[model samples]
Target: MGVNTLYFGVDFGTTNSSVAVYDGHRAWALPLDPENDLPTSLPSLLYISRENEKIVGRAAADAFIARNVDREVKTKQVDLGVSVEAYVGAEPEKSEVFNPALVDPEVRHAVRARATIEVNAPGRLFQSLKSLLRQPAFKSTEVFGTPYQLEELVSYILSPIKKAVDGCAGHAVETVVFGRPVRFSDCDDENRIAEDRLRTAAKLAGFKNVAFFLEPVGACVEYAVSVEEKQCLMVVDIGGGTCDVCIMEFQGGSGPEQRLAESRILSVAGTPVAGDALDREIIRNRIFPLLGSKARYGPSNLPMPQYIYNQILDWQNIYKFNNEEMINWLLAAEAFSNCPEGLRALRCLIQKNYGYLVAREVEAAKKRLSEVESTHITVQRDDIQIDDILVREEFSHIIEYTLGEMRECILEAEQNAGIRPSDINLVLTTGGTCLVPAIRAMLEERYGAGKLRSRDSFTSVATGLAVVARYV
Candidate 1:
């Protein structure tokens, strides 16, 4: 079959990405990370080596683990330059007459401070680039002394998926439909900017015909295929970075295009709090205390600064603490603290870039909690050893506020659809977060356990997008 005969859908999500193909009748998700032993979806990750070599997906994680973990960082100090300041002559005194003509001025100059950086570090690993799309201030970031635009970084993730899709199709496929959230940001303009950025990245990745579809709507479309009769359906897609809710009407007869044209879509709403936020809660509530969050230093025995521990709450932001200033502060704190073991471990974590390891453990614990009543989160490497038992009840309590927000999001979608909770005939939940027991319980409490239906948690959106691509 030629490329023109097929339709493609790319779910470029904040946490994981997947590509699906449809040839008018059949739709399936292509394996991007076959060796993962999990879902076919690819983890959204990028690694840039010291030599500027870029790697993506599973290989990226493997490369980071092989290079950064359990390695002692080597640092160096190098002079950057000197800064010179010019001012009026001291003789002018308080009178300080304005310069009607040229006058002698005093000049002060000092050597710029030297910066400490890891000279033998392997590379930098990045995740959650999709979350930065809506921020106007974040245009580019430096990687190995080279500046890379946001679109360029995004393209790094998309290009490989494009190549994989082409290999599967036996020819290059440039046309694609990508799934997007209902809102990348609270502001409409910012959301548009995020879409534009994503479009630009798709083009950079060699997509010739690109289209966008709401993620929740895509999930709804996938669920609609099995509907035997007309019914009110609500789709709740809670992914890594955002929670998207859609209320719609589903009937058996209509095709994807007709569904879009008709009043099938009643309402769509989304919030930025989702899986990652819950993971952060685990790190903050369960792991942070063991990592020196409660340590005290100085003669007065004051508690450690909250900001130091805050940096590690979000694994993606933990790299910011690797700078010279933060390192110096950590060293000072470690020397004076009543308990130096945790602070020392914290320093080791930053110096060796072990944040990814901690994130992986937390995510694994979260997954286990969904299936079991209790699990243990263990983060161990060199001097760092944190083992904590996390129970389902405690996990729910840790994420109580986040769960409340998600419930509100569902209510928002229902209210916008002009219907009460009872009006919904069926509930379709997708994405990794929906597998959480607390989240499932909340949905069951609202709509009854019998009404909740779950398709493929990871690939439904991509499949739905493929269906949309075929018809629309």
Candidate 2:
């Protein structure tokens, strides 16, 4: 019997991630866990608990909440008459305190505390993710993880995929294709080092063969397969971490020949500012204000609720920590410090799962408003009511901030190709965020509505990579 060749297409995104495999003829999107019909695509979240050295995924999401103190709980108990105290002295209150002498110590303490809690979280998270891969749905010869750098944490996530694929395929699978952004924020040396680490991790995960592909180029290959006619096309793959654009000449026949011409990458452009940032902004600006500040304890000034909210947001964006857990942690921190209003509100927020729920609603609303005229987001707890149906305008502002960079990339691509906008046949868009109307409109206006076309916004890149893996 001959060995069957299998190609795995991975879309390792910042917000959400997915993997698909092509077994010669057709491609199948693998489930993240056995419980769902769809391929396992969830937010790229990894939760670590310093206390237990445990990492968890969707399962940890609830644990985060349970561990997180409800902000609302602390707020409602305002009448309890607990001392409303600030950690730092009150002399510097009512003004922006940027003094390193005063700020450094507090910031150091918070950072150390957070770092300590997160230390063992990644490993535990990998373990939980590994458990997910062991499900019976994705049977393959061997499973592999695709990471930019082969850290144990990355291997943790990848091993499950390898296992699932290996079990499903019913053979000893080896060669795996991993995707990388066209550009990396790290230097060339660092990037190479990262790739080496990733390769090592895959080997440790038990994979025998591993290859790399530029994410956007991989997406182009996926798009080229189904393309019947050859034309000059620009592929824009806007993912969670970076925005990658590729200009390729697709020569079509039985199979398309993709000649990569010019590519542009924006390192700073990402969904961190788009999806997660909006969630945190709402929490800090809207939800936390309702909780009030700590002012009565020991006359020391304390970090503002908004400041803490930003920290929480940053944490969620970077580590994929459980939101409920994060909120509860915040609440517990406040309670331990005896901040009356904050502790009370924190308790309520935890009890009602307000922070996590509101974050989800905000994300949903943003996604909805992107496609439609308006959308409503309802964040309900017993006493807290946050029902703000966002219209296109509000969503537009949020999108515009990100689109500014996209527009620049478009111009750069045009310049690099040395062709005017009219010479381009189509501006093909991919990535989850390309679903936004504002982004679509901006591209249409710039490249001419006739020249603009959006491929499968969600799966185009992954699909493209599948084809690339088969041929490349």
lDDT per residue as tens, model 1, 107-218: 1122234445665768888888898899889899987689999999999999878987898779988889999998888888889999999999999999988999999988
Q: By summed lDDT, which 10 consecutive residues of candidate 2 come out lowest?
A: 76-85
Report the C-alpha lDDT of model 2 over 236-352, residue by residue, as the tens digit: 776544567777666566633333222222121211123343444445544555554442222233454444445444333223333334433443345434455554554444444
The TM-score, computed over Cα atoms with residue i paired to residue i, of candidate 1 is 0.88
Q: Estimate each model's TM-score.
A: 0.88, 0.68
lDDT at position 361, candidate 2:
64
Q: Enumerate residue pairs that collide in model 1.
A: none
The numbered model that scores best in TM-score is: 1
TM-score of 2: 0.68
Best by the lDDT measure: 1
